[model samples]
Target: MEFHYHRTGPSPDLATIEQAIAQLDPAVLVDADDFARVRISTVLDEYALLDCLWRAGVQVAMGELERQPSVCCGGCGG
Candidate 1:
């Protein structure tokens, strides 16, 4: 799932966010818009990712951000 993390002022550095994402369970960053926004992919349930971000000093907005559906087909028994 994707989430939008907002900051009070200037966005945090990439390294900082990356460090935080690392703490979460299998949270992979898909993309980011400067330091203000970020897109992530994770398999954690119950919004645990948000908790990780919060602990990392990043405030994530409520609700999961929407992402375009993937069209790539990679031999999934299709």
Candidate 2:
């Protein structure tokens, strides 16, 4: 799954966000666009991902959470 975080005000700490995501072992920070968005790939479900973010104090709007198409080779059923 890919997570896109939209910033509405002051930018949150990227390092902190990275750390938070790291807690979910399989989650990886695939890419990020300055402070406007973040793209993370993970095996964890959306609920788990969102809970982790919330617990770490990452505030994301309801609409900001998006599901992106996976860039897979279609060999592993990812």
Candidate 3:
């Protein structure tokens, strides 16, 4: 959930990035660490995600961290 973007240059739009993140999230498993990283995107990647998570008292499962695949099966679980 580490985020990195140019500070001096045109920055990654926070809302856009967050919306993109939301669109990507299937079940909103945004752990505290990930959420903190989003909240602190300007300083993300520079600091460890786990550290942010720890400070925010959040937990995450390794497997659940990755983006879920797009469903082309029309919710049929194909």
Candidate 4:
């Protein structure tokens, strides 16, 4: 529905991202496959996904990443 973002740094208390994100771009890349473990499914519901994030001690707002193509597509950009 709506887009929201929050930033968390080395120290969780000092992390703030909502002010920085007025509008979210689904195509935006948060990390470059570095300094991170695991990833989110693009097609998942934003709210439900946030629940998992909270259980893992992570905070999220709204909006979700774009869909990722499955590896079986033979690179056709499916």
Best by TM-score: 2
lDDT of each: 0.57, 0.70, 0.35, 0.37
Which of candidates 1 and 2 reaches a greater lDDT?
Answer: 2
Task: State the displacement of the C-alpha of residue 73, model 4, in Å, after optimal TM-score superposition.
Answer: 3.7
> In candidate 1, how many Å is residue 62 off?
2.1
| Candidate order, TM-score descending | 2, 1, 4, 3
Which wins on lDDT, candidate 1 or candidate 4? 1
Residues 1-78 of candidate 1 have per-residue lDDT tens digits of 444544457655656656666766444664567655666665544357667667667766556444435443767642
Worst 10 residues of 2 by lDDT: 25-34
Give the alpha carbon lDDT tens digit for every residue of 33-75 in model 2. 7767777677776787777677768777556688788777789
Top candidate on lDDT is 2
Better of 1 and 3 by lDDT: 1
User: Model 2, residue 2: displacement in angstroms?
Assistant: 1.5
| TM-score, prediction 2 | 0.72
Q: On a 0 to 100 scale, what is the lDDT of residue 29 in model 3?
A: 28
Cα lDDT of candidate 1 equals 0.57
- Between candidates 1 and 4, the one scoring higher on TM-score is 1
- In TM-score terms, candidate 3 sits at 0.26
Which of 2 and 3 is the better model by lDDT?
A: 2
Evaluation by lDDT, superior candidate among 2 and 4 = 2
